[model samples]
Target: MTDKTLRSVTIERTGAGHFTATNARGGEIRFGTSSDPDGGADFTPVELLLAAIGGCTAADVDVATGRHSEPTGFTVTVTGDKISDELGNRMTDLAVTFSVAFPDGELGDRARAILPRAVKTSHDRLCTVSRTVEIGTPVTATVADA
Candidate 1:
């Protein structure tokens, strides 16, 4: 078996119930406690899961595209289904929709073919959030032709 150490992140309240989350790598994100019945002002823990997956997917696409001759900006849309009961809510399934736009007459069909591969690589290997969810949650993706 391989040995792995748990990574740590620290969260501190910067103001009245508002906070900042800091990772071991020094990356920080803002978070707030909720008071609104509309569920605004707070970054619900569940939302972070989606953001984690989406962000990783986007980064994966970008990195993979960069290795190719024609790299372009990419967008990813993710929708998730959650289960709720007296216990709480948990994600049940997730769908990631990718919309990739390349410059007209870009790098021809080759780049297009490679794009899909990159996205797959991210989900298969690079995206921690996606893989974590995949163990218990269903994950799906659809590629858009540019």
Candidate 2:
């Protein structure tokens, strides 16, 4: 078993403007700064950030509500404005909107009723990604060998 206190991924340069990040479990995602003849279908770092924010909460809400009933239509849209200011380059006005619908009747009613709370719980206390952004943190960067 691995330590649950820490989670990490290793990123390596595949070529110019493109890179691959691999988690400890070996899940890999390729991304690049831009889509040129070389970029392929890879996602940009900003998109990944948005995904992480939305994904973390989406997972929490899904598990919370899914226990009661499955959603007929479920989608989470995360939007933000990337700006360069005193904070340097960062996303602002972040929003995670969930468009979820459940079937008719009690099972659906139960899920629907809890959806708002589930989303609120995630935003307030559960989602690590969003929480980190909201609370803020300092990131130190250095060359490992240095």
Candidate 3:
């Protein structure tokens, strides 16, 4: 097994409900909840979570199929259902649908055959975001003095 490395992002509140998350590499992503009046400018955290899953898998599939034939068209739609119980609100189910079109002829057939495997590999082992959600990764929170 490869050695495990720590990955982290720092999130800072920019406004009442808006925040900015910065990765170790200094890349930043803005996020907010629907309750925020300015939330329309950026994706909400929940939406970002869904995007992470879809984007990860899409990238993997694209690379996998590139070996056989480039896809003429590619799109992914990810949807999640939210449920509220006495405990709190959480996502109940998520669905990811991929629409891909390959070039006509034998190359297209080859790409089609590889699509399932690509998706399987991504969901089962390659996508860190989806795998973490699927396996229930533990998250610990603590507050530090400013």
Q: lDDT for each of the candidates? A: 0.74, 0.93, 0.89
- Give per-model CA RMSD: 10.2, 2.2, 2.5
lDDT of 3 by residue, 8-46 (tens): 789999997788999988999998877466448688888
- Could you tell me how far off, in angstroms, the CA of residue 101 lies in candidate 3 after the best superposition? 0.8
For model 1, state the Cα shift of residue 94 in Å.
Answer: 1.2
Q: Tell me the tens digit of each residue's lDDT in model 1 across 46-138.
A: 667778889988887776665554545567888888789786867767878788766655563555767888788988888877887776665
Determine which window of 10 residues in candidate 1 has minimal summed lDDT: 65-74
Residue 118 miss distance in model 3 (angstroms):
1.0
The residue pairs that clash in candidate 3, if any, are none
Q: Name the candidate, 1 or 2, with the larger lDDT value.
A: 2
Task: Name model 3 segments beyond 4 Å from true.
Answer: 1-4, 35-39
lDDT of 1 at 53: 87
| lDDT leader | 2
